[model samples]
Target: MTTTELINQIRKKKSFLCIGLDVDLNKIPQHLLKEEDPIFAFNKAIIDATHHLCVAYKPNTAFYEAYGLKGWKALEKTIKYLNEKYPEIFTIADAKRGDIGNTSTMYAQAFFEDLAFDSVTVAPYMGKDSVEPFLAFKNKHTILLALTSNAGAFDFQTKTVEGKELYKQVLDTSKTWENAENLMYVVGATKAEYLAEIRNIIPDSFLLVPGVGAQGGNLQDVCKYGMSENVGLLINSSRGIIYASSGEDFAAAAASKAEALQKEMAVELG
Candidate 1:
């Protein structure tokens, strides 16, 4: 989806929430284990329950990859379901892919062309060449990793090179590449204080921020510094919402959690 379309959805729904469909078989309701595709079954229920409460849904690729071909088929079905049923809702392949230029192009085609995700998370450690390939697609977004929520982010992202943090440099350098306007950055909500500074670098670019809820990133702090005139934030809450229950009523419980966040977001947008 285009940036304007995304912003419109936020306005219409009174939310910019991105529900992370990080489905782990071990964590889902035990009854689903009997289903032919437990992963997709769980995802369908969650999506059906919370679709109206959020504008985006991100399925982290790792969860499906770990399960091999069957897992991949489940993911494919999940994306197809979203595309056919709720085409207006933005879909993100949280695949965090980056490689050599040629490989990166194939990766781009896999997610953008084959799977038809609206966006994909990409790691920037390989420089502009590795990432620009993903940015080449029209209307499809390449969400570059900036300051992440993990403890290991301090190892390089926060480290200063020539007196500037590495992530700031990534943001600055990425804008110089071709078709860079389609780029967004992943700024973890755990580092909410840096949002103001990050905004100064790319004032209008959307941010796919995770690390809220189960990760303990404060939603209020994230909005205080990250929100722009267009509500340029996609705050993600995975475990907190999807795993709200381990019983048969899990989907309803997930809806309740999503509603709570959407209600707060409505007030924040107001």
Candidate 2:
């Protein structure tokens, strides 16, 4: 989806929430274990229940890859269901992939061409060559990692490289890349303090922010510094939403959690 389309979804839904489909078999309802494809079954139920409450769904690729081929198949089914059913909802393959130029091309094709994800997360450690290949795809977004929410982030991201922090360098240097307009970024909500400076570096780019719910990042703080005139943020909530209930009412419970967040988001958007 284009930036305008995404912003329109936010306006129409009165939400900027992106539900993370980070399904863990161990945590899912026990009854689903008997399904033909438990992972997809869980995802389908969650998506059906919560689709109207949020604007996007992101499936962290590692969650699917863990179960091997069946897991991958389950991911395919989940993504296909989303595409065929809710074409308007943005889909993100949170792969965090980056490699040599040729290898990156194949990864991009796998997610963008074959799977048809609207966006995929990429690690910017390998620099521009590792990222530009993903940007080559038309209408597909390459969300580069910036200041992450994890505790370990300060160890490297905040450290000075020459005169500036490494994360800031990544943001500034990325703008000089080809197809830079199609680039979005991953800025962890816990790192909201850095957002003002980050925004000054790229005022218009969208940011896919995780850590809002489960990681204890405050939504108000994120919006205060991170929000752009376009309302450029896709705030993700994973476990706190999907696992809201581990009982028979899991999907409904998940929907409730998502709806609550959407309400909060609506208030923020207003």
User: Candidate 1, which ten residues in sequence have the lowest lDDT sum?
Assistant: 212-221
User: What TM-scores do the predictions have?
Assistant: 0.99, 0.99
Model 2 lDDT per residue over 115-226, tens place: 9999999999999999999999989999999989899999999999989999999999999999999899999998888899999999989999999978989999999999
User: Local distance difference test, per candidate?
Assistant: 0.95, 0.95
lDDT assessment of candidate 2: 0.95
Put down candidate 1 lDDT per residue, 102-152, tens digits, no spaces.
999999999999999999999999998899899899999999999999999
**After superposition, which runs of candidate 1 have C-alpha atoms over 4 Å from their true positions?**
none
Candidate 2 TM-score, C-alpha based: 0.99
